[model samples]
Target: MKRYYQQEEDIGLFQRMQQDDPLAFEEIYNRYFLKLSNTAFKRLQDREMTEEIVQELFVNLWLKRHRLPELKQPESYLQTLLRNSVIDWFRARARQDGFAAEMLAQPDRQIVNATEQHILYADLQQAYESTIGQLPDKCRQVYALHQQGRSVADIADQLQIAPKTVESHLLKAHQTLRHVLKDYSAVAVALFNFVF
Candidate 1:
């Protein structure tokens, strides 16, 4: 009985999403977003980052709707993806923060063109802002300040709050955006091309 229900739901969602039905996508989001966000938050221990991760994942899933295979268990697949994304996030953070300098210090590093690098950075920034705009008001403001290259102290000063409050808001906003923009590479690339 359980398998039958899962199969039915998966088939319905897959078909509806393939047809570009917004309601179908909403159903999928409503069903999976919070659960996936929670899973990511547990692993990352940062609410804003987790939300952004999950959002990207779902957005990708929607964009790739036509290619999605029939899921044996949709919930399980979402959870697994969240777990993997969180791990990848931490790995990237470590690399960016110089924690993995030894691995990245290879002499054969291929240098990218300055123009292309700038375009990519700008594209990412645009996508990040678009994702942040989808958040609640407070989350959006906090995220925007962070993206504007403001430090926690600066944000606190601007908002007239404690530094810890800024940190907390940033944490929540990051998680929300992560979950909201999960799997957003395709959209980001498209937007990048459009702008550049």
Candidate 2:
């Protein structure tokens, strides 16, 4: 009985949100923020990152509110978004740690010889730099900033470029890197896909 009432209430909130009601958006955020935060924190284990992820989730919800009316269950939709965001965070962390570590950190590497891994790592490093060198000036700068953990918005502000422009630069960098890196190492290319 209570669940039915809650569903009805959620539907009402979504309807209002679809109509650009800030109060409805706030109500949804207030209702789910704690629940979503708890779930994200359990998966992330870092309070700051959990908070950032949940906050981004709400920001995105508000940004995409017009589509809320199409959702059958806002809670389920939010949960899925949170899950994907957590996975993306993990992938980004892995990328920042270095491609050699990403590729060779697995248990399977233990079965392979260290000398081979060292050669592979050196080759990958060379190819990575060479590929990066191929990027245009501004695109390279944006990619470098991103590699340094700067957010797209931050990079845009720092570079005095639009966010979409920053994203375009990033996408170009990733495509160029992925394409060139694939010829050198498929594993590197696979890990490289996380940039998106």
Candidate 3:
């Protein structure tokens, strides 16, 4: 039966993956990556996010392969993982927005004096630099130009890459920054909205 064959195939792949077989793991990735990406993109509508979620899911699958859960349908298992990842991603984004909103709504007792302004600027600068430093070389360059008010097409032209490549770098940089700069949620939200 079809179900029997699927079970046999998945079981073999799962067992092989557990034993650290790269071919088996690659087979699983090829089987599920696009399908999972489609499912995620259908819900998220953001190509970069969809790709990131699928990539992370596969990476996690490999890293935790030896302890992979027992399942009747491996495809279903992957779907569940992707779905959960999407939920978590949205939740974190919402939290970031909420933090920004809260910070904006809070009442300050007095106008910030020069010293306070200087200290605040220093903190923001430190966090911003640290976040930017973590980006890949191409991504960091794209981000720098983008920060200076360059359009995506402009960045691509300057960097001699496609516009889509520019967008991908920016998206990757944004995701990385937003993740590490969690405590500076207001800054993250502002930059996140500015980037894309």
lDDT of 2 by residue, 1-196 (tens): 4343345577788887778877777778878899889877866679999999999989988887766548666676777788788778876876687845646677566456456757776777788888788789999999988876576898999999999999999989877876777665444443333322
lDDT of 1 by residue, 1-196 (tens): 3343344575577577778976767777877788777756655678889788999998888888878777755765665566667667765875688745654564344233335557766757776677766777766776677755466787788888888888888888767656654655543433332222
State the local distance difference test value for candidate 2.
0.75
User: Per-residue lDDT for 30 in model 3?
Assistant: 74
The superposed Cα distance between candidate 2 and the true structure at residue 130, in angstroms, equals 46
lDDT of 3 by residue, 34-59 (tens): 98888778667789988988998899
Model 3 residue 98 distance off true place after TM-score fit, in angstroms: 2.3
Best by lDDT: 2
**Candidates by lDDT, descending order:** 2, 3, 1
Show model 1 residue runs off by greater than 4 Å.
1-8, 106-196
Candidate 2 backbone collisions, by pair? none
Clashes in predicted model 1: 23
The all-Cα superposition gives candidate 1 an RMSD in Å to the true structure of 16.6
